[model samples]
Structures are given as C-alpha cells and as structure tokens.
Target chain A: MTDTSDLRSPTPDPYLSMDLLRFTTAGSVDDGKSTLIGRLLYDSKSIFEDQLEAMETSSKARGDENVNLALLTDGLKAEREQGITIDVAYRYFATPRRKFIIADTPGHIQYTRNMVTGASTANLAILLIDARKGVIEQTCRHAFIADLLRIQHIVVCVNKMDLVDWSEEVYQNIVKSFREFSSRLQNIVEVTFIPASALIGDNIVDKSTNMPWYQGPTLLYHLESVYVGADENHVEARFPVQWVIRPHSDEWHDFRGFAGRVAGGVFKPGDEVQVMPSGFTSKIKAIYSMDEKLEEAFAPMSCTMTLEDEIDISRGDMIVKPNSPPEPSQDIEAMICWFSSGKTLSGRGKFLLRHTSKEVKAMVREVKYKVNINTLHKIEDDLEFKLNDIGRITLRTSAPINADAYKKNRITGSFILIDEHTNETVAAGMIL
Target chain B: MNYTITHLKQLESEAIYILRETAAQFEKPVMLFSGGKDSIVMAHLAKKAFWPAKVPFPLMHVDTGHNFPETMEYRDAFIKEMGAKLVIGSVQDAIDAGKIKEESGARASRNGLQTYVLLETLEEGGYDAAMGGGRRDEEKARAKERFFSHRNEFGEWDPKNQRPELWNVFNGRKHFGEHFRVFPLSNWTEMDVWQYIMAEEIPLPSLYFSHERDCIIRDGVIMAVTDCLELLPEDVPEKMTVRFRTIGDATCTGANLSTAATLEDIIAEVAAARQTERGTRADDKRSETAMEDRKKAGYF
Candidate 1:
C-alpha cells in the first residue's frame, strides 16, 4: 500500500498534525482486552519504569511466574481481585505521526453503559475477539453498540492467535463470519481484521512472525496511518456559548465577546450567524484565541467570537449560520443508554436534560423500543429500561432545544439525563 | 489576528470549558490549589475562564502543615495576584482536635489525614463541586476517574457507579450534601503540563527547580529535612542539588537529584526521564492498590 513503514517512522512533519485518532476497546471479560492494551503500550514504549516495576511486583505477589501486563490497567482493588473492568478508564499516548486516546471500557453486560460512554467520542472502535471463541454473544453486542454509536471505523482484533496455533483458516473463518454479520448493520463504514496474540505482542505494535499468511499492517501502524481527517463535523456550523466575556477594562470597555468551543464546521469572520432562542442575526466580527484573532475557527477549538451586532447571547445559547440553522424542538426522539440504579426510565418521568452548555427539565414521553443486544432484535414490548439498558425514547423538554442528529454532529446531538431528587445522571441519549 | 491552535491549546480550551461548566452547574464550586505546576496552571485557566470576574470562586488548600515554605509563600502571592479568596483546611488542626489520629513510625505522614480535613471543609463550605488538577496519565487509579467524579454525603467515590461522560458533555449533577470533584486536566500528561507552563509563562514554586537543599537519603530517595521529619541516629542530613517531581506533604514527598533550573530545562528533563512522576510520591509506594484505596476513602 502506501509505504506503511514510512508512515510509522518517527519523522516530525507539520502536515501529519491532522492524523490524531481516538479509539476505544470493547470485548468480553476473557477476550484479552487488557492484554491487547498492555501489548500496545509496552511495545510502543509508552509504559514507564515505575509502571513496569509496579506490574512486576504485583505479578510476583499474585504468584504469577511472568509479569502480568494486564495489571497495568487493572487499577482498582475490586477490578484486580475480580479481573474485570468496572468503569471506563481513558489512556493517552502518542506516536510520532499521531496522538492517541484509548478508552478502555468494560465488556460485561452490567457495564454496557460504560461502553456507550467510551464509544461516544471515538473515531474508531477496536472490537477484540478470542480466536477460540469466535463471534460470541458479547462480540455481537459490542458490534451492535459500535454501529449504534455511529463509529466510522472498526478494527476487529482476533486475539489469542497463539491458542489457535496461528491458523490462517481460523482467522479467515472468523473474518468471514464477522463480515457477514456486520453487513447487516445500517451504516457500517469500514471493518478491518487482523490476527494477533496480545499476550506475546504479535501484530499489535510490530509485524508478527507467526502470522506469515497475513499481510496487513500492524495494529499500531493502522492506528497511525488511518485517515481520521474526515471524522470531524465539517458540514455544519455550531457554536454553543459557554460564557460571556466582558473584559470591562479601560482599554476595551465595550468589548463583548461570546466565548464557546466551535463544535462543528467552520466559522469565518464575515459569516452571517444566528443566535438561538433569541433569533438574533449578525456577522462574526472577530474570532479571538487567547492573544490573537483569526479569520476562521473549526470544530473542537474553543475561542471567543465578537459579532458585528450586539446580540442577547448568554451561556446555553447556540450560535449557528443564519441560512442553515438547526431547528429548535421541544419534542425529541432518541436512543437512551440508561445509567442509574435508582430509577427505571418510563413514560412521563421528569428529569433534567443537559445538552452542550444547556440544562433544561424534560420528561420521557414514550419508550418506543429496546434492542436485545445478544439477538440483535428489537423488543418493542419492553418499556422499562433499567441500568445499562439501551432503548429508543421520546422526550419533551421544558424549553426548545437546538440540536442535530447524533450521526451528523456528535458534539451537538448528545445529552445526559439527571435525576431531580438524587441529582444523579440516569441516562445518556443520542439523537437519531 | 491569526489564531492557530496547537494541540496544547486545544487541550487548554477543553479544560477551560469543563471548568466553566463546573462553575455554572454547581452552587458553590471551589478550586483545589496545591501551588504545584499542575494546580498553578489550573489557577491560570480558572482566571481565563472568567476574565474580570475574579475567578467566580475561592481556592481551597487542604494544608498538611508540612508543606515547603516556598510553596506556601507562592500560594499566598498567586492567590493575592488573582484577587481570589483562599481557604486553608489544616490537617494539623484536625490532628489537634483529635478528629484524625496521625500515623506512627517511619512512614507516618499527614497525607492520609488531609482527606478528612478536605471532606470536612467541603461539608462546612457547602461546596457542590471541587475542581482539581488531577491528570489521568499521572496514575492508573486516576485514569479510571470521570471528569466530574461524584461523591456521596460522606465524600466517598463509588468508582463502579460513575456517570458516563460522552463527547464534551460532563454530568455535574449532585444531590444536597453531595459534591463533585471536577478534574479539568484529566487528559493532560506531565509533559504536556510542563510544555503548557513553558508556553504560557506560568510561574511556579521555586522548589520545582533545582536548588541546594538539606535532605536525608532514605531508601535511595532524598527526603527534605523539614521540621516534620524527625532525624534518626542512622539518618544523616546532606546538602544535595535536588528538585521535586510532585509537591505534597514534606514528610512524604521525595526529591530527585536534578539540575533542571528553568521551565525549558524541566521539559527536557521530563522528556528524557523513564520513570513516572508519581514514582517519587512515597504515599503511592505503600501498596499496589494505594491510590485506589485512598480514592475510595475520598482522597483527592
């Protein structure tokens, strides 16, 4: 292909700055998830001396002959004793070509909400499959959730090749089965397969000597070279106001800038914009980034915008292009990932809805359907959604919310439901 | 003007956004300022979050009373410069009041006792949110924490029941008597903090840089010869060129032999170092699950 070796070289170039990638790992409890992460971190030299020492000592105390690299991520006492991840732990490391953020999520059925959390912002999802247990129920559940979350890229890491004796036939069989199943997904953009042994560090960060029949790039190579430039929302302009900056100083007494992060698309200084809720229209006069001003700002950059006209803008209000403004709706239909143990979400349940910078009271109007993750079937009769349950629900808000479909703009389309009495987050919802 | 955002700038924006959200969502939010590089950078970000508004909250320091004199001085000056209110919850006070008994022996430190004082202060202040400079890359236990970590009425964090933080949406909802610990720099690493401080020209305590200090060599670590550390017949004090990788109670925080004098020097040193910064914290070296144990007991 495209000289994968050259891409993995540690050459500092400015153009390679756009290659930043965020991915998540999901699999069953025994699918070698932690081993895969440990292999990636260790082979990439991301593990520190202290961390290695700690891992060695812990391994010795646990009566293991070799260093248990999985202990690297099993931080909690309960997690170590039970050998399961109870929460989503985020890890950060960088190769010369790109920076990476890995959301190590739990794979148990009870912790499915954590997976939803991890997959929400990820550009790619790496679903691990044990070679011995190819395409099990948990695999289907993880794949379906990946599809539901609209993850653009998926790298199926068939781990434990050592157990399968590095058989090419077994690898091809698993790949074929996964492909046939994934084809039924609604919007699966891409799915690539790689046979690896995470415990022995094969095909994770370097070329595997065992898998001679396979010719695909290593996991780290794929991560560094994957084209993620298109992951950002470049089609719609959305700016959710966080705070109003009024320097109120003698030098700039009249300077009023609306401070917020650019959530989607690009905004130039001369672009005509509309302020939500107030329905005020104006042109962007300036885009301030700490010390300097810019002509344009894009997704994920936090900056202050000074409009040509002084609009009644405040925190929780959204700024958008005048001609292509998102519709404000009080009634929203979304897929909800329940996260609270105190209450099961049902019809006419009052709670708080927190969208980007905005919190408004909302009520669940209807529970349309719940997906049985194992069977990949919709259970329309089941209306009650407890903790870690995912279902389609309609909600009515106290005030009209400016929004977009989650598939279109991840930054604007996501929301969390908060319990009124306990003030705990009860659910996570993604707009359809 | 042309405003180009480097990766560090993007991270700063994300941190500032989270800080603002905490301030807006919680009734009384306080920033935990430890006068270290991370907390100092966090204080600066807080200032930027509410320009001309005086940070919109007070800064609380759970003082172990065994802090470096330079760090205390730096904390006062920085707080004064920002025109923000400062509140100190002393572990010494807690010990004197018999609220928390000090640990005895060679490993005795006020590090664990600070948790009790911190929780008491949160209860007394009725603070619904407390912002910390904790970064996920610092330790494995920290890696599992949410940006908005919820604590019970007793200030206990149930790591198993954390809210799902998706996208940039942080859930800061908490009940009465309950508080949220907000970590704005969860994604930042030690190297990133140094680089940001260097680029932003953020001032730090002089203890972070190399200087000649009287220290005792114990278990291959330079222990600062402070009043809290009682010299043993076998332990001899020696003057050495040292700098702190992390700032904590003087009794437990160890110093490393280094000649990194400036921010740039520190950046270079960190880039070349193979050991993690927490390796220097004697508190974390107690056990494999030291951090997790402390976190479960409400140690921030």
Candidate 2:
C-alpha cells in the first residue's frame, strides 16, 4: 500500500463519518410526512432508549394507541401540546453507509415560510404523497418550493401505500402524474418515486415484499446511495475574504493570508486572481490548511491563502479568477421569498442587502410579478410583496456587489434583505 | 466551490465560517468556554479560523463555583496556550451581590444559577455576540436552534419566531443592546465531536477518562463525590471506576461506571451507548419543559 500522510488525515472510522445527506420532508400534515421521518429514524437506530421511552410515556399520557411515531418530532412543548409544528425541527439519523440530517417542517399555507426555511439547506427533499389524495395542491406547492431552492435530488415517497393495497397501478399513476408536473420545475436534477407506508415499515428500510413488481431501491437505500458530489458550482471561481489573518507577532512577521471558505471553483498556488471592487490582480503564493502547506485548495475548504502581491484586501472583498470575473453592478433583478411579517418593499424603502460577505443598502425598484406557488401561475400588477410571497423584483444597491446568476453560482448569486430598523432578516433573494 | 471534503472537514469549515461571521458581523463578541469537550473543540476551531491573527474574540466562562478542579486547571492552561482572553462571570459573585439566591439540600446545584450570571456578564460587557458550544443533538429544545441564535434586549430566546438561516449567509443584524448566541457546534453530534477530538488530537480534562473516583449511586445515576457537591444523609461515596460523558456543574453532571480510559474506547462507548450525553443529567429531569424553559430564559 502507498503510504500517504498529511496534517489532516481521515479519521480511523471513516466509514461511519464520511458521507452525510441533509434532506427535508414536505407535504400536508395528513400525508404521513412525520411518520415517514419517524420510521427512518426508528429504523436507522438513531433513536436512543431514553428518547423512545419519553415518546412512549407521552403516547400513554395522550392515550395514543400503539405508540404514535409522529410524536417523536414534536420537540417544543407548544408543538407537543397544540399538535402543530411551528418551525423546522432537525433530526439526525445514521446507518452503516451514511449519516442524515432530516429537516422536518410543518405543512400548512400559513407555515409556508417554515417549509421554505427547511428546504434551503437540503440537498434532497422527500415530498410525501398520500396515495388516496394523489397529486394535491400541497404536493405541487412543495415541489415548486424545492425547485426554487435548487435542491437537486427529489425523493417522492408515495406514502400510505397500505391504504391502496400496495397496488402498482396506483403507484404508477401517481408517479406518472408527478413526473408530468415536476417537468415544469427547473434545476431539479433527479426525482425518485417510491411506494411506501410510513405507518407500517414498508419500502423505507426494508424492501416491501408486498410490492413484488416494484424493482426500485427502498427510500432509505436511495438516500444512502444518491450522488451529491456535483451539487456545488465548480466552473466559476469565487472566494469572498471573510477575515484577514495578520499575526502581529515576531514569529512570522510577514505572514498574511486571506481566511475564507471557497465559494466556487478550484484554486491552486499559482492561480491568478482578481480582487473585487479594487481591480488588483495577483497570483496566489501558497495555500495552508493550518501549519501544513497544500498544493491546491477547492470549494467549501477552510484553508487560508496568501497572494504574491501585498494588495489591500479585507472582508466583503471577493477574490475571483482573472479569466472570468464576477459582474460588479449596482442594479439587479431577483426572485425573492419574503420572510418578513410586514410588507417592507418599496421603491424608496431601504434595506440592508447581504450578498456573499458584503452588506449594502438596497431598495426594491419594482415588484414585477408574484408567482402563485400552488398553481405555478404568475400574477402581475401585484406591486406589494407580503410575508411568504415569492415574486420577481428589481433592486438598486448603494454599492456594487460582485455576484453571478443564482443558477450559475449559488454562493455569490443568493442574498438576504435585512431590516434597517428592527434588524430582522426580511427576505431571501436569488439573482436572476 | 470545486472541492470535495470529508464530513469532518466540512463540519470544521462550517464552524470556522460561523466564528468568522460572528466576528465580522458583531461589534463585540466572546466565545463561551465551559471547559467541556464541545467548548474545547469550538475553541480549537476558533484558533484555526483566523490562524495568523489572534482570535478576534475573547472567551467568557460563566463559572458556577461548583466545578471540578481538573476543569479549572484545563481552562487556565487552554487560555494560556491559545493566548485567548478569559472573562469569568462567577456565580458566587452573583449570589454574594444579592443578585441571585443559592439553593440548598440534596437538589442544590449552581447549574441554573449560571444562567443569571451569564446574562449579567453579557449585559455588563455589552457583548453583542456570545459564541457557545451548545449542540442541537444534546437536547430537544436546542435542536431547533440556529447557528446564529438571536436574543432580545433581555437575552431571551423566542423559540416561536427564530430567524430563518439559509445557505452560508447568516443574518446577524440586531437592534441596539440585543445580542446573538452563536452556536458553531449546532450541527455536530456527540459522536462527531469525539471523532474530531481524536482526529485533531485535542487534549481534554482528566475527568473525561475513566479513573478511580469516589462516587455514589443516586436516583439510578452515578454522582461523583467531588468537594463541590453536597451529599445527603442517605448518600455515601464508594470507590468506583467512573468517567464523565459530559462535564458541567459538578452536582448536575453524572459519571458512568466504566473503564474506557482512552479516546478510542470512549468513542466506541459513545457509538454503542443507548442514552444521550444529556440523558444522564438530573437537571433536564426536572420537568418536561425544563430545558425549553431554561433556553427561553437564555440558558446555555
């Protein structure tokens, strides 16, 4: 065996720790969404004895027959008492193959904000479809939201299959109809259809022998094996300097490096990079992962880089490839999901626009149109954007933010609008 | 970015990003080090975040006064080695100043008292951001926490109206006098932490390893017979091989009967262990909403 050693080597138990999948579950409350997640956690051996005991105790106290698995996710006291999920509750489960973080969200029109919040960080979204209800409005709404967030993998769990006798005809009909509707959604790379009964263990962890005609993998199997390596933007190079590291000590008097997680593309020691807002070009001298120097560094890695030239660079300044630089502009158009309770966008109204590492003053120049998520219809002339509203709007920023189209580079293209007075995050915007 | 990293490295990057966000977004920030494994790991990440520069923030410890001497020693050594400033908000001082009252009897502990001291310190220091080692996997209430948890002027958490965090961009903007409790270890599980510690070769207090300690079995949990503890008439100490899964207040933290002395042994035990690290503590057993209420009132 070739001996390879580095400052940061893989842990001894890499099998249990390497792969991680973050997914969100979405649907109407009665679609067995909670039960599906509960089954996954229960079967994956993620549930501890004390937690199960507490759930059983609560099940008894509530007179819930046969131990309601759905009760496992109701973490807050109000949620447990009111039987309504208020926000997204994250649950962790791991198998021998991979680890998973489940962002379980509430399903209600009023809780659309909650669903969007959960779906933002998910690589895959499990859209639970009630076998009886078929393709409902909530199903369409959830898929549209997931697609808007650019979640690549979509696992459509046609739950409550037992209610439909696990019939292949029903499963096929639902799958065919869903595919027809999902074709309209953009940026969803993969969609999986599985007939499962979350109430009883079926096609979740164990293959359901009842569905003899279904040859696809189980829900848990797909989650463990789904490919997520190419999810990040690898073409455009974007590195926003988060902090400048200058030791002000005698140990390394001239040591100066830019500390940041790579936003897009790959970077090497001799790569030519152009600093944003200042137009200073320099070659990267070295990359360091702590005390160890590396030949190359890439996206999402937390290594610091030093440049050949002593150019002035600070937080909010992006270092991009000189070959193709990010567009620096003061005016932009975007699709935003309004997260504020109050109607806060207007031509003259100002908000803090946080894009990449820079925060600038921005105002909505115009609200062009609002897309009705359920029907996927655009409603024009709706100039006012309210809470949980997804609409296309034009904005003017006080200063130029180096950015790209959201579809091209998510890290640089996406931003959030923060309120100036209350300091609450009011909206999530994607540059169009 | 065009890079693919291991899960441990991804976690480290995410944590370091959060620390940098806290430093860049806030006026004044402090990392809350409890002398626990999570805090130790967090401190280590902070060191790596801005390598060439001194850590942009100081560390604050809400000392309960009922801490194991080993933890105190470890905290001091860690501060010295890392060259991080330490701010100790003492619970004893809070009680002595008549700002809070002390509890008595078998259930007496400074675990809850640390909350008052912590809030007082945050207010006194005008700390705009307080980085904590609280992990979501530790408790039910904490599971819903954001990487940047915002608190009102009173430093209270509104579980109902938490800001939605998306991508790597965290919204840390807050009103004057309000601060955020940033949990860099929000996504980390206990197993992940132990695995990272072993991979990083981070040092921990001796209390984490199994050793001959005087302990007593109370309410089905092993309570270490430390000098900070107040024993009852029915409670008696016996020599037993024990190790603490977690370290907090001496009275509330429980030790497990084991001989898993090394880091690998602890990792295996944590993997096979049936209960959560917090499951053994008596503090969360107070009520169904014990942790929830404490969190709402700004408890770390």
Candidate 3:
C-alpha cells in the first residue's frame, strides 16, 4: 500500500516511496477531456503561480469567459491558434500517493493516430462522455482503441454534470449505455464510472456534493489507487538483448555483458538461459545493474547479464529460460494500425519490421481485414489500409522473429513497420 | 515496497533503455551535455546502460562563452572521471568567424546564439543523433516533444508532421540529410530530476547549492552579477543567499534566493516552490512561444 501518512506534507521526502501512474485521456471535441486534465492539475496545485498567470493572460487574449483550463494544454503554437491538439502532449502532476503522467490526446475522428500513440504506454485511460450525449460513436472509438492497446483499467468520466442538473438517473443511464458498448471490448480488465464537472470542480480532485447518489471515489482517488502492479507480465522470462557491453580497458578487460531491459519474469544469477535464434544454452554468471551485482532482476528492470560460457551473442538476441521459448517463425500475423497519411499500406508491399531489438524485412502477404472501431466490426470487403485504420496482416520476414502473442508480453509482442523508400513509420503491429 | 520498483528506479530504467536504443540505432551518436542536473543524470544513465564499456559516443557542449565558471570546472572533472571524449562547439568561435553576432548591452545573451553553434557542431561531427536532457514538463512547447525528435536537413523541427511514437518502439528512421534529437529524460519532471539526483548521489556544480552571491533584482527575477552582463545605471547589486534552479548562459539564467544547500533541502525547496523552474530563465520570458520558435529553429 502507498504510504500516505504525509499526504500533502513536504517533510521527510514524500517523493522517494511514491509510485507512478501513467494514464491517457480521450474524448471528442469539446467533451472536456482537456478541461478535466486541466482541472486535475489546477486543483491538485500542480500548476505553479507563473504557469497560472501565463494561462490567465492567454485565456483573456483568446476572449475566454473564464480562465481557460484547456489552454494549459495545447502547447504548440499551431495547436493554440487552431484551438485543437494536433499531436500527443504529455502533462505531469503528483499527489501524495502517486505521481501522474497524463498523455492528453485529441479526440477528432481524423486524429486517431494521436489517440493510439497516447494510449500505447498508458496503464489506464480516461474516456470522457458528455452527460447530455451519453455514449456516442467517438466514445466507442476511444474505448475500442484503448481495448486494442490492452489498457488494463479505464475510468469513464461522465462529465458536464452541471449541464445535466447533476441528475443521478442521467449518470446511471450513461453508465448503462457505456457498459453495453464496452462489453464487446475483450482486453480491458476494469471499467469504472464517475460523474464529474471539470468546469465546476466536482468529483475530480474532490468528491462532488451535488451528486450524492454516487459513492465511488473521485477521479484523482481512483487514479491513485488503481492496481497496476500486475500490469507487466511476470510469468514468462524474456530478455531481448539491446546492446553488447565490452570494455577493453585494463581494469576489466575480459568483461562481456549482455545488456537489455527484462521483458518478463524474474532472472537470477544461477538461472540457465537460452539464446534465441541460435538456441545456445548458457548459465547466467552474474547480473549487474550499473556497478552493483543484483541477486535477481525481473520485468521492466534494466540490467546486464554475463554468461558463464562465451557464446557468439550480439544485439537482437533474446535470453530466456530454456524450457519456455517464444515461437520462432518467419511467417508473422499481426494487427497493425497504419500511421502514415502520405502512403497507404497495400498487399504484397515490402517494408522493414522492427520488433524488440531485431530488425527484419517483411513482405505483406495479405490484408486480413480492417476494424471499424466505432462499430466493433471487421469489414472484410475493403482491404485498403490507410491512415488511422486498424487492420490485420500476414507477413513473411527475411529472418525468423522470436515473439510472443501481444496478449502475453507487450514488449516482445509489439512491432513497427517502416516504409523502405520514405523511411517513415507506417504502422504499429501487435503479434497474434 | 512489495518488490515493485520505485518511480525513480522505473524512470531510470526507461532512460537507460532509450540511451541504449540511441546507441544501437544511430551510426554517430553524441550526448548534448550542458552540465545541468538533467544532463548529469543522462550521462550517469548512459554509464549504467553500457556497464564496463565506456559510453559509446562523445559528449558535446555548445559553449555560449557566458557560462558559469563552476560549470566548466565540473564539466572537465566529469568528462575526465568518465573517461569519455569531449566535443566543444564554441559560440565565441561562431562570432569570431563572423557566422553569428554576439548581442551587446545589459539584456544581451548568447542563449539564442547557441542554436547555430550546436547545429554547426552536429553537422561538422557528422552526428546522426544527439541525445538531450529535455523534459516535457519544463515548458509548454516541450510537452509535445517525442523521445526521438526528428530534424530536417536545415535542423528545424516540424511539430505538425512529427512521426507517431508508440509503446517503447521508437522509429529512428530518417533521410540522409536528416538527423534525430533523442531525449531520454522526456517523461521526467523537475522534481523527479532532483529526487533521482539524490537517489543516485550524482555530483553537481556548487552553483546549485546555496551560496553568497552578488545579485540584482530585475523585473522580479534575481540575476547574478556576471562580467558579461552590463549593469545599468539604476542597477544595484546586493549579496544574498541564492541557488540556481537551471544552468544556462550566465547572462540569462536567473538565481533564486534560497538557503537550500543539500540535495534533501533542495528537494524540499522544490516541493514547496510555487514557480516553475523555467520562470527564472529570462530567455523563455521573451514571448509565450519563445521556446517553440527557438525549437523550430533547432534550439536545444
């Protein structure tokens, strides 16, 4: 449990023991997603005096009736002038229980890439639904994308309670409709509902007094207490080698360590490991995190491992327990979300596929189908994969890729396709 | 702690992963070390990322010729201790070569001129990637920056056309003339940097700690009395206990009045600080889109 003994105090180090929560906010135009984020930052006292003063001046210049909280976001000059978020913007704040990183994304239907990019690393997602509109097509699209990204927890903020007269029946109805829509999403572990008024400061940082029928925690409270400890897969031991560390200096001339971030499970010094692609087995001599020799390392920990046997190993090799090895195949099937607007992904197209630390040239054998995110249906007739389109594809790689299903390991299961001619990242792929 | 990693540890690991990725992806990678706390943390993470092996790339500093004397001292000591190569891009050299002009007067600062020197240095070194310590929480414009920020041949940032960065999969692909500016500390906040500095026990310049210095209050900001800064007739210098929240050109970086001498004290002071760290940076005060304008022109 998080120690909130000194919840709001500045004594004895409140930051050392605190955990971190990274979440994404998704809502359509004027649904108050940015306003909700601004409220969270403002009410938490995260916005400094200078920032607030600047925001106030800008708000007045833009002829806003109130100090526009949404202006706190929309960083780029283009974004500010257009009054819309063109790309993903990251915002940071902290409470006594946790530090929060909010990936604030735009909600326009055309800006689906921004939403996907923001939802990629988030542990939780905040989908704001206008109390009047209830669950709309944009809400379903956001929910579907969040589910496709495998976000564990989602906090559905039914905002604009003030506009809806703080009606409990309205909030309940929206909750029911959202449940019916979200039941089709298979990957979300938890869905929580809260009534909020970002403009009126209700049920965001503090519990709303107007909505007394709601007994759930505030948005901030839910964000602080959400269980994301088990989000990383700790069952499969997978370590994709990122670099080969070797120093020729006299102090340590013979040290050859394999450096990588652990993707899954716990790895100890005496654990027997297998090198992927080569299938060579070796025993771990030691694990060193910087200068200290760690007894054990696990998922998400960056460490260097020295093997007892000096086998031919380099970057792009995976070190794992010999008993459970990932499927090594040249044929790959994955769900890809296209990102490039200048080019469209076509069948029989060839590109560079990067997964883990390995890079292989892959040719698309076929376009399986494109997903209609709002409807949650796969369209089989249209095979054209354009910008912001989520579809499945089969590809044959130049070399065998050792990968796990995206459901099992996010690190090893994810890949990106890069256009050979333009060198732009065309699509993000999830291994099936 | 229940076997879970602390936020600092997690941030450190993420940064290390990025540093490693930069080294593996780019042909000629260099770290833009500004002798600030953020850059210090990046260098330390780079060391940890490739243990036993020396940091693969050189450390480059665009010398504004108006830096704190303590910064240079610390920079030399740090590079020598790490046994890493050092590359200097001198703004003074650019001025001397008639490529850029040095601003004159009380408000004159080489802060804006460092961009030209930095770009020239990157081009001269043929570096395809330069790692920075830029954080999203520092400024408004920086909030939208990616971990792998691309630059055109002219070294300008196209914010609207930025590539989509997802998960931990960073796309470093670029054309021949294009290069990437990689920021490993993009997710960290100012408070996080201080906490990580405390946890790692990394050494910093004494300017960060409280010291007695002659300063003049200009527009509600405390500016350290430096030789490069031309004093106005109405300016009066007074000795006070002050510390620097950020280290930029001596002409532009402001000193905050504080008695926080130790890292613990600094952390506490930062927690209680109501002003953003960049509030002291006079360069950013020029306009609302100051950072954005400079960034679009390839400013670090």
CAPRI docking class of candidate 1: acceptable
Candidate 1 structure, TM-score to reference: 0.93
Predicted candidate 2 versus true structure: per-residue lDDT over B1-300, tens digit per residue: 324566677788889989988898899999999999999999999988888678988999999888899999999999999999999999998899999999988878787888899998999998999999998888888889999999999989999889988888999888888889999998889988997898778999999999998999888989988787878899988999999999999989999988999988898898788888888899998887899999999998
Candidates sorted on DockQ, descending: 3, 2, 1
Clashing pairs for model 3 are none
lDDT of 3 by residue, A1-432 (tens): 133324434564667788888999976558887778888887777899999899899989999888777778889898789887888889999987799999988888798989999998999999999999888899999998898889989999999999989999999899899998888888999999999998888999888899889999999889989889899988789999999988988998899999999998889999999999899999999999988889889878899999999999999999999888999999999998999999887789999999999999999999999998879788999998999999899999999999899988888899999998988999999999
Clashes of 3: 0
Weakest ten-residue segment in model 3 chain A by summed lDDT: A1-10
- All candidates' TM-scores? 0.93, 0.97, 0.97
**lDDT per model, in order?**
0.84, 0.87, 0.90
Instruction: For residue A412, give model 3's deviation from the true position in Å.
Output: 0.8
Pairs clashing in candidate 1?
A: A293-B1
lDDT of 2 by residue, A1-432 (tens): 011223334553653346678899875557788778778877777788988888889889998886766677778898888877788888887776677788888878777788888887888999989999899888999899899988999999998999999889999999999999998999999999999898888899999988989999999899999988798877788899988888988997999899888988888899999999899999999998777788777777777999999999999999989888999999989999989886656455689999988989998888888999889999886657788888898999999999799888778889999988878888998999
Select the stronger candidate by DockQ from 1 and 3.
3
Best by lDDT: 3
- What ranking of all candidate models by TM-score puts the best one first? 3, 2, 1
Judged by DockQ relative to the true structure, which candidate is superior, 1 or 2? 2
Could you tell me how far off, in angstroms, the CA of residue A24 lies in candidate 2 after the best superposition? 1.1
